[model samples]
Target chain A: MDSTCRRMRAEILDISFSSGHGHIPTCFSVVECLYAAYEVMRHDPKRPDWAERDRFVLSKGHAALGYYAVLAQHSYFDIKEVAGFGAYNSRFGCHADRTKLPGVEASTGSLGHGIGIAVGMALGERVAGRQTKVFTLIGDGESNEGSVWEAVMVANNVGLNNLTIIYDHNKSQGRCLPVTNPGERFRSFGCEVVEVNGHNVDALKEVFARPATGVRAVIADTVKGYGCKTLVDNVNEWHRKSPDAEQLAKLLEELHAPAI
Target chain B: MRRQFKETTTALAATDPRVAVVLGDVSVYMFMDFHRANPGKFYNMGICENSLISVAAGMTATGMRPFVHTIAPFLTERSLEQIKLDCAYNQWPVNIVTCGASFDYAWDGATHHCYTDLAILRLLPNMEVLQPGSRREVDALMRATYDSGKPTYIRLSDHPHDVETNLEFGKGTVLREGKSGVTVMTAGPILPNVMAACEDLDVNLVYFHTLKPMDRALVERFRHDRILVVHDAFGLQEAINEVPGLRTWYHGLPDQFCAWYGTVHDIRARIGLDAPGIRKAVTTLLETPSA
Candidate 1:
């Protein structure tokens, strides 16, 4: 794992332990994907509402903790402020609200909604004759929603070359309905599909930098828990579980351990 | 009313440049001139109702005024969550202009019928619900609030009442004032029937185009009298009840579906919303002894 992502994982564990609120594994799954997005997107952290800036929506909003950490790393806000996440009257809720948060473009919690809104943003840019690109990240689990497919079909039919969908194929829906062969599915829907190891920020950034012919779908194959071995091994157990003091120390140690 | 919608929206698009129309393949032919005049401003975005709303909300976020037009039931009911979350909750200013109000597509069966749209949508925060009863009202209301930067749902009907109304956004008009103390309240296309029903009877008539931000002050003015909410749908009665200290009864849809296939007028007549049927209900209310 990248040292910065490892540090972000440690931060996630710390916040989860303190606030007792987080989907830890899901948050871990998209760290690099979110990081690569911010690195490649044409956004000024200081001017989030710059009319010419590119837009990104976190369709699978369960991983808002990861999103906040990445936004903080990019200087949208201080990571220290995120400790108050999910607390009463806190700007950062369990799911992000666009009005409250600085970097969030759309407030998305209900699965299958953010992608559709992202489609509109891209199409709206085309209508206005602007060069703004719109990106959205959706989970393999969220792909279970019919609205997700509906949005994909609409984006393709509308010929939105400015729209790119980052599909986090983390296989979190191993127990329920898993979206198998997502790259093939997106290809069938007329999207330019790319497969990449999601945790590799370099490969993800390369894919994000490339121009596309039509609506693009980056199938990011990832592990539910990417950094800590304990969380990776016991994914279900650590899915929504906040850590105790001992558990947090163990997770942090595992995250910082040298890889073979 | 759909023609009025196209006319008003077409006019707005000429100058505003932000006005875009997204259709669900329902009234594509009516907007042919519009599609030609403004190339990229209009899209026949297929039958995905949920995506239509989400896309419209997206367009609204991009500084364009978008109108999502389609059949009433599919646009409002099938895609309720999109409207509630993507538009209302997110505070995106998209205009939802739907046709096939109530039994407008009655021949297509119960799947096409929609009476719950206005009632359910009015409950969402930061939503504006309007059922304009005439072409004039449609034109005026669209001009008033199309770019107000609020999520607005305008339910257009094939059966406009053809009556001259107050034309205000939230204020209801007193079409007739009678000595008899009974105030017959109604909304949308049902007003013509309501008008004919109360023509001979000694009763005051009240009409509304806006459902939310409902003319509460006007509703309060008729509080002393028995307010009989007569309409072809569920929302007007619920809206009237928003004002306290008023006695209101709904004369609209029953608990079950109007299962038979017919025209909108046929269904209305069968369900006691036509002129004579409405007159019978009003006369019975007037004859009943006051409590």
Candidate 2:
């Protein structure tokens, strides 16, 4: 892994472990994709702030540690801010604040609302003659909000070709598996649905690189915890758990070592 | 009042290409002139309040000024998150025109009655809440929202009344001046009720059309030891919370869902929002001793 991606992963593990929230593992998987995109954008001087630069929105803002880590890696803001996560007077709260945080396009913690905002953003850019693509990451459970479908209908009706919505299908939100498949639900809304293994970085990169002719929905099939052995494949408990001293020690060791 | 909003919004849209109107399925009956004049700029966003505001936000981002029109309850409560995040947090210069403030939808029952809109919308930052006292005030505030380049919430009464001659944005106008034993502050259609009650008592009548960026200067000028705020909204709790100094009392509905049946007049009479009730409240306040 590159230095920036490696450092960001380590930061996510540390911050999430400190918060006693196990959902950081899910965040780590998404950060890896964001870091890869940022690295490509940084080296290319010709198209900086290019209207076509990939846009990322954390629709599931509860897992914000992952987003802050990735943003730091991209030099969007100071990396030190990640340490202030959930602190008093800190901009880095449990839910993302778009106004305070650089690279965060929308403030979201409320379910089913971000996608609608993203749809509007995408449509606005298109109408302004900008070709920028808008990507929003939604939780599987959050798809239950009626407003999400309201947004879906609008996006499709408006023909938002540059909008891409990703569902972090982690299967569990605090308790049980999602009642339905987000991919199927999105398809019913007249969107192009792509289901893939979310943890596979290369797969994520490929899916993100391919732009849709119309509004697309990507269901990233992922486990709640995909890396650490104890947390890996565990959905319910790791959705949010503060790491104890022993667990923290083991996590630090695992992150320091190379990926198996 | 609703006709004034329609006429003013249409005029604004005609002159400025950046100005657009989004109707929440109710504009078909109200905004005929706007739709006919500016077909390209007008949108029927259907019955979805959430999508309506989101679309307006998008329009604002694209350098278009958007005016969203709907019933007060649907416009303020149903899409509250959109108002907070997309409009207020982003600081978008979108105008929200809500028709039928208070118990205007008296026959539609409690669900349609909007009694808490002002109390909730005023709390949001970068939002200017205006409850126009008459059709003239509605026209003036609509023009102000267009020119001010700020987010505005305009509450319109279904029952139009005589306009306050000297209405100004951000300033409360004195309708009646007297030795201040009791000062009655009100807005929207309730301004007339307060004025009628001012005849018997040594009452000062103040019309508070602009709720946000409140007229603190005017509110501080009253020497009255007793304050009575009469509003069509959920009593006068919100108004009392905004001003300081004298002991305040509210004359509106209690903290309960509005019941089905009765006209706006009947509901106001039942909830003690009539002129007699307002005068009684003012009298009771003047008699009470300050602790």
Candidate 3:
């Protein structure tokens, strides 16, 4: 991993561990997706709401730390704001709050609402005569929601070629269940579905860079805790469990030391 | 009144690019012309009311002022959390226009009946709830809604009302002035029934088109001493609570769902919301002195 991605991951680890309030497994899984998304998606940290800037909404919002880390690294706000993650008086809520963060597009912690919100933005951007693309990161588990399907129809019907969704296809859903193949469903909805290895940042960036023929869904095959050995081996347990101080320090040293 | 809403909205959207209509798969007849004229601006968001509302909120982010249309029950009650969290919480100026209030779809059963929209919406922080009584009130309210710059809900009824309306958004119009002893205030399509019920009485008649920023001063003054409030939905009691002291008589639907299936008048009469019912309640109350 590069130094910038490593540093962002370390910051996510520290904030989640310190706050004792974050979707750690979910956050770790999408580090590469976020790393790659910002690479291809157009955005200026200084002008978050610039009329022509591409908009990204974290539909699976419990993993807000992962998104927040990227925003911090991009200099949207001081890195110090990350230290207060999940605090009583902090802007960083357990779920993403748009009012609290400038770059955060929609206040989405609820499952199934993000893609619809993104499609709305795509619709709005189209009507306004802007070429800004809309990107959304949705969990594989979130695809089960009926509203997600509802949004899929709208996107395909409207031919939202400006919108792209990268599904964090981590296979396992809540330990008890597993996710079915998403490509078939997305393809059935008339979306141009593409399968890719989510951990490969270069591959993730390549798919988004292509000319979107229609509403595209990139099904990213990922592990729940991709980088850290501790969380990945026990993905369900670590999904909501933030590491304690000693566990966090040992994991951070291993992750930051770059032997993974 | 619903036809007035349809005409005003479609006409306004032609001239104003900022105006957009979002639907949860209701009111297709009213919006057929709108869809053809402005296809990009019209969004038929299917039957998912929750997604419909949140999508409308998202549209507002990109410099579009959205007007969401649907059946009153589904728009306000089914997806109420989205209205409060997505729209009102962020103070997005989206207009939620609802059709079929009270017993408008009474025979369609309990699911189609919406009697709690006013009460539920009135509790939200930045929401202004309005149930206009006539076509003119609908026209005036729609004009004001475009510029209000806050989340607003416009509840309309199939039944029409004519009470000489002058609907200034937050203020009420005095239809009849009487001695200080009695004041009868009502809102929405039920105003006509209230008007007929109070014909023989020497009481003040005040009509409110806007429910949230209600004429609080008028209510505090007239209702503080003695007043009778007639509202189509469950919000009358809460609207009266704004001014503490009062000998108040409220006529509204009960909190429970309407389980009975009947015509609009049958259900309204059964629930004591019809002309005879209002007259009986008003006459009995008028006989008593102010506490």
Each prediction's total of clashing residue pairs, residues at least 3 apart in sequence or on different chains, is 0, 4, 0
Q: Write the per-residue lDDT of candidate 2 for residues B1-291, one digit (tens) a residue.
A: 878888887888778877778888875677777878875577776788898887787667556777888998998999888898878887777889887668888888888888778778788888888888788888987887765766788888878679554577888887777675667778777777777776777778877778876777777787354667788785234644666555667776787876756888888888778888877887777677562
Q: Highest DockQ: which candidate?
A: 1
Clashes of 2: 4
Model 3 accuracy (lDDT, Cα): 0.83
Chain A TM value for model 2: 0.84
**Model 3 Cα lDDT, one tens digit per residue, A1-260:** 65777777788888877787777778877888888888888899888878989989888988888889888877888767877888888998888788878899888877888888888888889889998899999998887777788788888887889999889998767555556878998999999999998888888899988998899999998888767788778887777887889989877877766576
- Candidate 1's DockQ is 0.88
Tens digit of lDDT per residue, candidate 2, span A1-260?
44565567667777765664435656755665455444433232233334455556677777678777767666677767667678788888888786776677667777777787787677666656666777777776776677778888888876789887877776765454444767777888899998887766677778877868888887887665555555665545555776777877786676566773
Candidate 1 collision pairs: none
Q: Which stretches of candidate 2 lie above 4 Å from their native place?
A: A1-7, A17-22, A32-54, A177-179, A252-260, B36-40, B58-63, B146-150, B199-202, B235-237, B279-291
Interface RMSD of each: 0.6, 2.1, 1.5
Estimate, for each residue in B1-291, the C-alpha lDDT of model 1 and write its tens digit: 999999999999899899999999989999999999999999999899999999999999999998899999999999999999999999998999999979998999999999999999999999999999999999999998898778999999988878889998988999999877889999898888999999989999999999987999999889989888997888889889978878877788888999789798899899899999999988888899473
Model 3: runs farther than 4 Å from truth? A172-177, A257-259
Error of 2 at B144 (Å): 2.3
DockQ of each: 0.88, 0.40, 0.60
Question: Which candidate achieves the best TM-score against the true structure?
Answer: 1
- The TM-scores, one per candidate, come to 0.99, 0.88, 0.95
lDDT of each: 0.92, 0.73, 0.83
Q: Give me the candidate number with maximum lDDT.
A: 1
Model 3 residue B165 lDDT score: 82
